[model samples]
Target: MGASARMRLQLQPPAIMAEVERLLAGRTRDIRLKGELRRLFQERSWPRTAKIIRAWMTWVIMLDALTLGLNAVLLPRAIALSMILPACILPPAALASAFVWTKPRAFWLQRLSITGGMFFILMSVALVGVGAGGEFYERHLNIMLFVATTAIIIFAVPLRWTLTVAAMALGLYLFFQLHNPRLETGSAVAATLFFASGIIATVVARRTMNILAQKTFLLELRDRSRVAELADANARLERLARTDPLTGIANRRWMMETLHRLWSDGMKGRDAAMLMCDIDDFKSLNDRLGHAEGDRCLVKVAGIIQSSVRRNRDHVARYGGEEFLVVLPGADEREAAHIAERIRQGVEAASLPNPASRVAPYVTLSIGVAAQAPDDAIASPEQLQHRADAALYLAKQAGRNRVVLHRPDPPGS
Candidate 1:
């Protein structure tokens, strides 16, 4: 034998045995959890199951009509007449059941129609067999009925209804056999055995299919849960990417994107403003007190800036170390300057002690304000940002704790 065949011969038995054990364990757990099976099947597989039932109903109706037609030719007049009404009524009833398949509340009507049709077929066969020749006819008819029961069970109806229909048909068949004198003891025993075997097989087949269906539903649910978790994780990662860890505000990258968006809006006839803010004597604070104290001061200053810009359209970002930027849409130079002044005052009012500071006894800010209207030809967002930076330099040059606005050069300056 080849290497693969040899390996298979050595390995296949253990693998098959292991799989068999696993399946047995799974079957036991499924039986224990059978109460939940109906609910899960309804939630995930009801529509498909309904369609299968409808299709099977159509096929069963066709097959029943064909069998009845053949039997009508061979059976006596009374049996043929009895078969005629059911053959005429059942196909139409099955068609009507198809119409309600989409309506879940009306599902029982389909089940009843299908089970009722099967029961009628069983009764018709029994009736025809009783009125026909002898033991030969009864034996053949019972076999046919067993085949019909097996067909119905193969449609995989829910277990409760399956059991109900099986019980009714089997009980009716036994009653007929007991009443009929021509059915010999041997024939009766054989018929009963066949009927019992078919029912057991039906139950086993339905249970196996149910187990498979439940496993598929569980896998789908797990996949959906994993997808939702992945989506949530992606959202959190995106938020972290754009947010400053220290200040709990927009970071430099987000601020740059906001500047670009505002600049685009500015080109479309809207006004936007930017304010650059620097903590006065931040290096000195970090030097005298520890960097930990400097971090606390930055957090306090960030809160002040965020609170000072009360408009919902405005955003604040930590541009870099000890510096923050604000974007205000639809704001003019005056509004931007006013907002910057409030931020400077708010920081000073907080009275964060800065011993090494020259600006004030407490920490303060130097802010630069720049505004652009739609008509202005500021070629890019960088130009507006540069103007804000220059104004901030001017603010620090003149005084460490004040606001300064950028001005374009006059026509003849």
Candidate 2:
């Protein structure tokens, strides 16, 4: 064939170029999937990884441009001008730059471009051997190309895929070298050195991946533990807020909220009742028996009151140091007074030592009862409380240890 015809034949794509493109496309897909997996595990942020990949791509483009420029400079003007090799290469570098700068999802396309560029460059070198008998690889050039390719592959792809592609490319390059045997001993040694360097990089990358995986697992475990501890603490706080510390009954806050909810649900009917009771002469009792005995008496009285009001909706709470409140959602005023009387009787029956006894020789309670129909003209919860408190004041005035009912105002007496 004539020299010009032969040169045109060298510029056309070879069968191997299609295979290189397919492999690179698959590698790009694997790299994208691996990155998504890392993000799913929260091991690395996607934006950060993308920035790093782009920066690495920029460096790779720089290195490849340097290699091509050097190769162009070293070639004789006649030889360099005779081939379309340089033009074939510039497009891939330009695509890679655009991919980096424009931030497109062209990972596969960019990779395919690079693979085609390498295959085309190798073919050019191979076709040149048909006419001229010069060394196909210069030591410095092979070393630079190998370094640049290895860096790009390791940074842009998963470890296994990177190693696989590197192995295939190296094998093909070695096969070409075996056919032409024109490489100087120094060039062969440099190839070997570059090959050794690739092995070292593979080892380092694998180690880094293992460390990243371990760190991710430990951080996930730590976060789970912290969440569990916080949930447990919240449960304990809820329990404390709802329970009376001294009596083990529902606290006033919990009882008030429950009563308001029940009242809103139409529980404040004529059958529902509330009772407020207090230990008679509790301050004198504390003075005579000391606060310790007073506390014991209060505890004992709370237990008795809770026991007397033993229905599911019958709630008792220590209203204050020496007073208690009870809510009965389905009991009349008389039944509620009876229940309070039972509590007073239970305290009297205990007959434990009471040095503060003025009348009963032990602690006694005066209770007040109030009832309301669902249609009653009650303005607020405080009004109900005020009526009960007024009844309790009257019970105390009528002498201790008695129950009093709230008196309605007479109309136009």
User: Tens digits of per-residue lDDT for model 1 on 199-298?
Assistant: 7787777777766765555444444445656878999998999999998999999988776776675543257788999999999999999999999999
Error of 1 at 33 (Å): 3.4
lDDT of 1 at 258: 72
Runs off by more than 4 Å, candidate 2: 1-207, 234-245, 248-251, 264-271
Enumerate clash totals for all models, in the order shown. Answer: 0, 0
TM-score for each candidate, following the candidate numbering: 0.74, 0.48
lDDT of 2 by residue, 235-278 (tens): 88998999888767778888788778877887544367778888
Error of 1 at 63 (Å): 6.9
Highest TM-score: give the candidate number. Answer: 1
